[model samples]
Target: MTRSESVRRAGIENKPSSAEMDNIYYTAQQLDTKLLSASIIGWE
Candidate 1:
């Protein structure tokens, strides 16, 4: 399923607190950086 669909299915439409948003953004950024690094390293 698409990300939006997954979020909708999980019922995350309710507004999240600033701290929650911050944490989510932080985690996403970290994951993105790690993925980029892994790609650069050409790892399996």
Candidate 2:
């Protein structure tokens, strides 16, 4: 599945709101440290 699809699925499974996902994606993008999925995994 695509990254967004994965993120959405994770959100459903983990119960994090969309806003949290957006924040994570934005912060990770600014840092250029890792893919959003990696950050999401770390968050979990």
Candidate 3:
């Protein structure tokens, strides 16, 4: 499977699994960090 597909599958498998195993949440946080960095650069 593709990387995105794997991540999606991991998300599905993570729900109702446990907070410690939430790949989607971690991925979203990482994405947020990148977005924040981009926005900061745009402001400069």
CA lDDT scores, all candidates in order: 0.91, 0.75, 0.75
RMSD of each: 5.0, 12.1, 6.1
What does the lDDT read for residue 32 in candidate 3? 91
For model 3, name the residue pairs that clash.
none
Query: What is candidate 3's lDDT per residue for 1-44, written digit by digit as tens?
Result: 88768878778542345665587689889999999999989943
Q: Which candidate achieves the best TM-score against the true structure?
A: 1
Q: Which stretches of model 3 miss by more than 4 angstroms?
A: 1-16, 19-21
Tens-digit per-residue lDDT, 1-44, candidate 1:
99878898999896778999999999999999999999999965
Query: Per-candidate TM vs. native?
Result: 0.64, 0.39, 0.49
Candidate with better TM-score, 2 vs 3: 3
Name the better of 1 and 3 by lDDT.
Answer: 1
Highest lDDT: give the candidate number: 1
